[model samples]
Target chain A: MRLLLTSATSEFGRTVADLLSGDHEMVLTDQTRHAEGHPDVVACDLGDDDSTDRLVAGIDAIVHIGHGGHFSSASDLLDVNTRCTYNLLTAVRNAGINRVVNLSTLRLLDDYPEHLTVTENWRPTPGVEPVILSAHLNEYVCREFGREGGIKIANLRLGFPLVAGNTAAAAASGESAALAGDDLLTAINAALTADLGVNAQSTDAPHPVSFRTVHVQSPFENGRFLLKGAASILGLWEGQGVA
Target chain B: MKILILGGNGMLGPWVVDALGDRHQLRITDIGEPPETTHEWRQIDVSSLDDVVDAAEGMDAIINLSVLRPHRKIAFDVNTRGNYNMMVAAVTHNIQRVINTGPHYQLAGPSYEDWDFDLNPDMPPQPGTRLYAHTKALGQEIDRVFTTKHDVYLQTLLFYHLYDPGDIGNGPGGSGVESLGKDMMTPYSIAWPDAGEAIRCAVELPLERLPSRAETYMVFADVPHSKFNNSKARGQLGWQPRYHLESLWNKR
Candidate 1:
């Protein structure tokens, strides 16, 4: 598939592009202008509708990994994060792209009572925190698009995507919310290829919303967010050597 | 101060109107006719930008109490778009303060049956599958955006279940199946009077003293194995609930 990987300059976007390069044709983009010699990367700002439309025109699918950094002012984050995502979705619809992968955060489940196995179905505690609420609105954007039909969205609610060697230390520091790079790659790949079977009559079958939120956390014994539907939906547990 | 209470005709709206009416100049607006009240009442639909902007003119602050049933179209209209309209109107009119009412579904699991632990205001919102919760969560985001950009003070008070024990066996009773546990609900439910007090505190608290321009508080009476931590309301807003689940049983 020809894939559009947004925010390719960010750590997560770059890593995902590199990992998926072997199997899929990749188109990389970010808000920053691309270097002159790198013809393979497309310089696009998702906040601009025309730029987003041009970038998504020929792609078969999209991996939306862009976000305003942690230091952005609250208003800036809200505008850039939401407008960019909304713009991308609108362009995706106009461009006739059928599948999209939105990167949501595990922080949405951050306020749940500890030790209770958190599921995708848990309601997020509402608040005014800019980044977290932005993530929430992003999911709503995906849902709105999904409701419009002809689009399939997989929202991966990821934990801290840490470097391979640093995972142990981060986990040990009582923050059991870090995801290994390999796990993140596997989860995305599964999301890209999974047969959602939206028409199945069983209650467990994926709903017709065509938009699903799956928790993607490394299987830590004491992790705060539970990876309930990730294994069955994304096949993240298939060969990870974890249960 | 002139306070505009949007959705002031709903279930909890009357109680809030009663609580704050004498202390402040009150103006109530709702799509339906304003319930019998001496305060200035206007029939306005919050989803209409024109209506909200007109009603918001010269108001000191807005107390948004409007909510819609979980039906998809109406929920999106009244909760999501209505909030956007109100925020824009508030900013346009230079109204600096807005208090939004949201539900505790943000903390509750998929349903009341799946609830497990106490949630604090600092936690992220999880609206799950309910349309009402999802729209209300989106409205809270509108609050954040407007507060950040327009320098408005926005506070969202997320209420759990609100009910009077006296109404339990009288009319059309509570919804839910028989297998549902009372224990799961008792901790999260709030008496109507206590819920009113929380709203009053949110409206009257001095904004300059608040820790942040945007804030959220969980308002509920003290219940056993409660799923919400009310310390922020207590320490920040100086709010305390005089009722509890035991108060309902004790009345017998």
Candidate 2:
């Protein structure tokens, strides 16, 4: 499938590009003009409507790095996540690209205690930290677009400090919420191909719409966040961690 | 108490100034020049965090009336990032109270407006992709995050159509949408002065008296259609509409 990946120089950008490059037709873009040794990434400011529309044409799906990282300041975070995202989504829907896999983080729920079974149904009490709060804001924009029935958004909230190895290594790194790279790839693949509906992932919303949130984490047992939404909506299984 | 009013030269700003001008000390800020007022005014842009932070210093509370509907770039700047700057500045200065104003669609857009009635503000905001509603909703969401995380109180008063009591049918371009002859007006509509009064009510209400750290009030009057419910605002803020918009529902 043809895909457009945004923030191609941000955190985990190179890793995602390298991993997904062989499998699919990739068009990568970043706000910055140049990345060392990789010249194919088209420089397109996601905030600019003309640039985004030009970039979005002929794209089948999008993988948006929704977590607001790799920026200059708090203003950059606010603009990129809220304004640039709004522009990007508006351009996408206008261009008839209906599918988006917004990459968010599970840290928005880190405030909850260890014992509680935190799932996608539970609302994220996002702290004032710009990155986390901006991520929550990204989900809001995606949900509204999905709710409008113009797009089908699968907001995959991945575990933090996404590591590129087995779960054993990730656990050894001491970040309890670490997600293995393979699990991350699999979740994105599922989101890209899933039959998303208004009520696909969310069970608690009285009137669920197209935007779905799935908590994707590794070591599928006794993790900080439960995977009810990912299991049902993204067709994720425990074996996929090792598969 | 001393209050900082952002976008204090806009349409709703004067009404808010009218409501609170005599009672509380107000410091007004806007990108444009202000109306003739004895209170202090500053030419500030809300999208700039530095500008907002500087404007918000030493104030007891901040009231944001900034809104830009038509232009996309300026709209997002003023509407989306403006809220971000407000919250950050509020926390920076340790200001505890803030009152924000936006259209009702910011919380309940066409997703609710098209199909539902008795629409309250507590429902999850589903503001579909209309520019004004979408932009303003993002601001509200930003404000919600700051309220949850910081040592601050947020009160948002949402209004729909704004009408003048004397010029009910006589706004720009002759007979307006708020006329007496209208059979079915938007149930979320409120008069301009009443909208301002809602701000005063939000400001005066004690923080301890608030039911929650963050509260949103659907700032409409007692209309007949009952399409939107103002019970929360009425019960909590004790705000009653001084203008009788009987001509809207009762066409006598």
Candidate 3:
């Protein structure tokens, strides 16, 4: 499939680009304007109409791994995450691109200090604290796009991305190395090839909505996938009947 | 057998009634008569422990889907006191399952800046704001106590938004209809369906296999950016959701 991979300059994006390049035609872009080794890079600012328009034309699928800092002001955060996503999806629909892989953070699920292993069915209790609530808003936008567009949307939430060989500092800094590029590649590959029907809705055969949310995390070697991103990849793979 | 539902007229109670109604003996009680169909109806204030006990007697399963009224005192009364009363009644009555509605806040808390970790069902309840959320947290705590002390199966479902095409015009009161649609379908809202599936699993799964504290499930489509997890529900309980937000909303 022809792919548009955003955030190509980020560490994880670079890894995914390298992994997928051998088998797929990849078009990479980022707000940074310059990606070191990628020659087909484009400067697409999600905030700009022209940039969104350019990215949406002719791409079969989008790996929207783009994100900015969380703003203290709720409105600013919404503008950046929620509205920015809205612009992209609208552009994608207009351009007739129906498949997307939305890269989301696990923080959207963190509602308390007691630690919760959230499932896709949990709904944000309105009036939540701003930061987490804003993230939830971003998640909501993605699903809405899928519902309205009938686009095949895959949301992969990563915990702290593990930078290879950065264990000591990574641990002390509380950064997760789990969401690294290679880790994402596993999920991306599975999504690319997997059937979504099985994972798209319950096996009980309910009619699917325009959207689906699959957890992608590293699977436990025992054949169980946990770690957000791996689970989604496996579920997508299982849904698709891909080996 | 005999099933009792607190706030039986609310969002999920009606569905639970439909799913289990024909199979088991069902009795429903709520403060107001909910619009849907059900087997039996009794008027009861869930906030009052006395009323809860009276209604809970002679039921196999007690499903509570009432939203705590926003008044701090009332919210506290119904959510905290009323929840405790329901737990005690279940224990006393030997109800097979106690399914209470839980929201996303049970897993997602105030400390997070953005998505990072998939909600782990094994994680303990987190800190939250709002009297309603506070009460829900308390209900989970009470459930934990009952789960251990009485061997009663206590399940809390952190439900997602239930939207109908008809609701789009008026929206959810304060929010505009268009914005409500935009907000409800987001990736973070994925847990909406898992809430129902969690309830289903709670009733279907054997008590011996349930988690010690509480469990959460996601019930929406597989969106790429979501932070919830459904591994335990799928792997442990072998359960899955039967509906997605759009289908659920549009179908009925």
Candidate 4:
């Protein structure tokens, strides 16, 4: 399948691009024009309506991995992040793209009990933190679009993506917050191809699309996060491809 | 200055009346009868637009302390719609300043069980699983919208845990004192007097000193390992909470 990966320059996007290059046709785009080294990446700002429209055309699926980081001012965070998601999803709907995979953060569940293990069924507490709130709003936007009938959304609420050089060490150390790059790729691939069933009695369309929020984290002993559903749903297991 | 307080019969109302009653011309309103206080009192429900307009006339500013319990129909009506009503009335009646009170459920804390960070006031609201958090967040959003459109200055003061001084000595096993030592909400506690003083500062702060037409501040006592940052309250309002939760434990 043809895939459009947003924020292809970021660590998450770059790793995804590297892993999925052989299996599928990938078009990578980012706001910053840093495509000199990489010939396949196309520089496109998701916040720009025209740019989003142009990039989403003929794309079979979207892997939304772009967001202003946690340190952005509240105004910029809300305006840019929400606008990007809104613009991208709207354009995707118009383009008749059915599959959307959004990269949400585990921080959305940051307010849950520290001792309790979190799962996909855990509801997000998107309190006043700008980044977490924006992530929740992003998921809400995806769900709204999915409810509109033709779109199938898989929102991966991933833990901290492991850094480039030290992922193996981090995974070996059993850091609860770390998610290996290979595990992220496997989750994304599952989201893109998983048969998430159907919503037969949808209000907007006779066959409403399926929207699922899955938690993605590397296996850690006595970790605070539960990965039971991710193993079953995304076909990912702990230490799946670690060298 | 003539200040109209909606929901003045709430838990924090009497203290607020005591804090500012000596200086400001205070008019207290709530659905219940006014508590025995020196200030003028009236029975007014904020959910009613006309009722709010009637009470808001001739007031220089308004302080909205009204809160709705979750799982009730009035939670949305009073918390969300009531806030909208208060803003409309404030604008219609030419009230220049409005102080709104909400809980700190919007911040990452006990309700968010997984969030383990010291949050500042500037952080966006989370509004976890609780209906009250969502409604209060909607109210703050309404405040933002109205402040942008109208000439009103709005301050949303989000409070954490509130406790009365008298209740501090009630021992650990009392009905409301059960959660005193609970890690989730212990350090975030605020005294009634401090809450009142914070409200007073929100009311009296000069409009020129305000950074924006709409601002939010987290009001709570200084606690060790506090999840909330109250620097906005300190820098902008020149307010500091005098009471600490540690003092309560120490006294007990």
Candidate 5:
């Protein structure tokens, strides 16, 4: 499947683009042409309207993972994080491209600890402070867009999802190995390339691809499946040689 | 299936073990030796994840009811990290469900100093506090992460302050049961049976359907002045707390 990756110049995004470019037809987009590494590059700023229009034009699905980590102010972060995501979804709707795998951080509910158990029904505590509220606003946006769009949207709330190093090994630093930089790529690959029989491990990345939606489906393993074996059903690993 | 109560010697732990023991295999553990009961007993410290993992092995589910009081680091280590380690072990072993007794502070967000006891999980946690509340908030977050990311069916029930009338000597002020020193109990209210019922719901409900984050249930008997809201427990989990101030206030 042909794909468009936002923030293709990012360290992780670039890595994903490189990994998928060999197997899938790919187009790269970013606010600026930071790196000319990809054959198909589009200079479009997500902050602009025209960029949204152009990005929605021809892509089959999107790996929407572009944004600055820090913000100048609380409002700026809210606008960039929440509005940028909304714009992407709206653009996708207009472009008629439905599948979106939104890359999110563990910070959506970051104030909590690693052991705390929250189910889908447990609503996050209402936000009071500006920063906390902003973080929540980001999550609220995703939940709303995903619910209304009727698109296949998978929001991965990564738990210390690692890029390359061992987050757990820094044991004292509380950092260790995490979902690889290519983990999202693997998720996209599963969403696009795999067939029904795809097992856990594929040529694309480590860990078997099992994509589950947290919205409607009961978190229970035995409950109704929103999209069972979505990773394999989408043929996310079909082109990869990781058999 | 064997059920283990990690903080079995504490206020709610023993009661929960008693309430559920008739039908389930009950095992009790704590920093101290488990009290004598029909259920099997073990001495364990859940703060050490390995020990918890070992104790949790082969158990159907593990309920954590232990906590360190007043000590910030201790509370954090036990409530947050300790909870994580226990859940990690539980998830790795594929324990069916893990029930935790989350602190009431998660609901303390919207509450004021005078209103601290009236917390509801739905309210944002009260901010800028020192001691137990902060540690508990961290613990609740950890609960959210593990239940969501690791696929552990975690149920966290936030309990109100517990009061045992039968044992007033145990009260903080060293007051005797018959000759109550002062009538301050009106302000600090908790119905033990109601608390047990809420706890029962937590253990029985399909945890995965519930959010993995901290969830709270008020333990007070229905009182005109009761500040906690436990309707969610009643509506969703089929829990009905039997004791109320009207029922227990003048009886004893």
Candidate 6:
């Protein structure tokens, strides 16, 4: 599938770009012109609907990095996540793009006690920090579009402090939760392709909206965060992660 | 109580001021200078974090009536970021209460209003298409997050149509229209003073009296239109509307 990877210059964006590059056709876009730019990257501020529309044309899917996605002010962070996501999804609907994978963080649920197993259905307690708050705002905008039945979004609230390799994973091992490179890729790839109707054969299935929030994390040995929501809604198996 | 009112110069600002002014001290802030009033006013932009934090200093609570309806950029700036800033300030200052206001459509946009009746505000906000509704909904969601995390009591008063007592109900040949999608959306109706009273109720209600840290109340009067309900406001906040908006729905 031809994918449009937004905020293409961020570390998270670059990681996803590197991971997904082998299989899919990637069209990278940054909100602003980057000094160190990628060959596949096209700079476009998503707040401008016309430019965003032009950028999204001919794309099969989008990997929207919901957080650490913008290279702008904290105020613009709110716009890029909420209004720009709204603008981009509006464009996606206009362009008839059916599927989108929005990268979010499991830290939004960090407020929950460690002993209690957390799932996607639980209300995210993404308290007042701007980046987390902004990403939370992104889910709100994307879900509304899904409720409108215009676009289908797979919102992945992945684990905290996304690590690069085995060594870095080892370095950050003691942390509450962490997502390694391969697990992140597997979740995104699954989200991009999984049928939202995998279980719901009947027309009146209880799918509230075209959107599904799945918790994705590289749950290493006896990890507390559950991947059941991802497995059921997105078909991403627990075994497939980097455990 | 010494309350800081952000975007306190908008349409609902004066009404809120009128309702709470005599009872509590107010430090109101808006992007532009407020209308000639004796209330303490400051030229503050809610979108600016510094501006909001500065104005929130030494305040017991905050009332965010700041809203921008047009221009996508400014709309998001004031409606969404403004709320984020307010929540951050509320947490920073340890202010215990916030009275947030927005249109009813922010929760029940065209999708809810067009499809369902007896609509209540508690329904998970489905603010589908309208820009104003969408932005304000995002703001309200931010407030919910803050209330969940902190000790702040978030009383969001959702309004739709603001009517005056003396003004004539102008509908199709003076017949009541349940809702007006005619020029723009006025999905529910409440007198400005009644809306103010609802804010006052929220402002003064004992924190223990609130069911939760975060509660949303639809603030319109009991009009004949069966579109939206304010049972939550009445039952929860003990809000009572003085004007029933009889001309708009009842036979004159």
Tell me chain A's TM-score in each of the predictions: 0.82, 0.89, 0.68, 0.80, 0.62, 0.88
Instruction: List model 4 lDDT by residue over B37-151, tens digit each.
Output: 8788889888777899899999999999999875434665677667768888898998889999888775443434355556777765556424576556656765666786689
- DockQ of each candidate relative to the true complex: 0.08, 0.71, 0.01, 0.02, 0.02, 0.73
lDDT tens readout by residue for model 4, A5-52? 876876656777887887899988866544556667787656434677
- Each model's TM-score? 0.56, 0.92, 0.45, 0.52, 0.47, 0.88
- Interface RMSD (Å), each candidate? 8.7, 1.3, 15.4, 12.6, 14.8, 1.3
lDDT of 6 by residue, B22-85 (tens): 9999998889867777878899888898999889999999999999998887888899889989
Comparing chain B with the reference, what is the TM-score for each candidate? 0.88, 0.94, 0.79, 0.90, 0.80, 0.91
Query: Which regions of candidate 3 deviate over 4 angstroms?
Result: A1-243, B34-38, B113-115, B165-185, B190-198, B211-214, B244-252
Q: Candidate 5 on A1-243: residue-level lDDT in tens?
A: 788777676675666677788778888776554435544567665643666787778788787662323334533443444446656766776777767765554444444453444433345553333344444444544554543434556654443434442212222233321334344445556655332232345657643322323321111222221222332354332322111
Q: In model 6, state the lDDT of residue A76.
A: 73
> Positional deviation of B78 in candidate 5, in angstroms?
1.4
Q: What lDDT does candidate 2 reach at residue A22?
A: 71
lDDT (Cα, tens digit) per residue for candidate 1, span B34-148: 6999999999988777899999999999999999974555665677667777887888889988999888774343533265456787776556545577668777767776675
The per-prediction tally of clashing pairs is: 9, 1, 75, 20, 44, 0
For this target, which candidate reaches the highest lDDT against the unseen true structure?
A: 2
Candidate 1's displacement at residue B199, Å, is 1.2
RMSD of 3: 17.8
Q: What share of the true interface contacts does candidate 2 keep?
A: 0.76
Cα error, residue B14 of model 4, in Å, equals 0.5
Better of 5 and 6 by TM-score: 6
Better of 2 and 5 by lDDT: 2
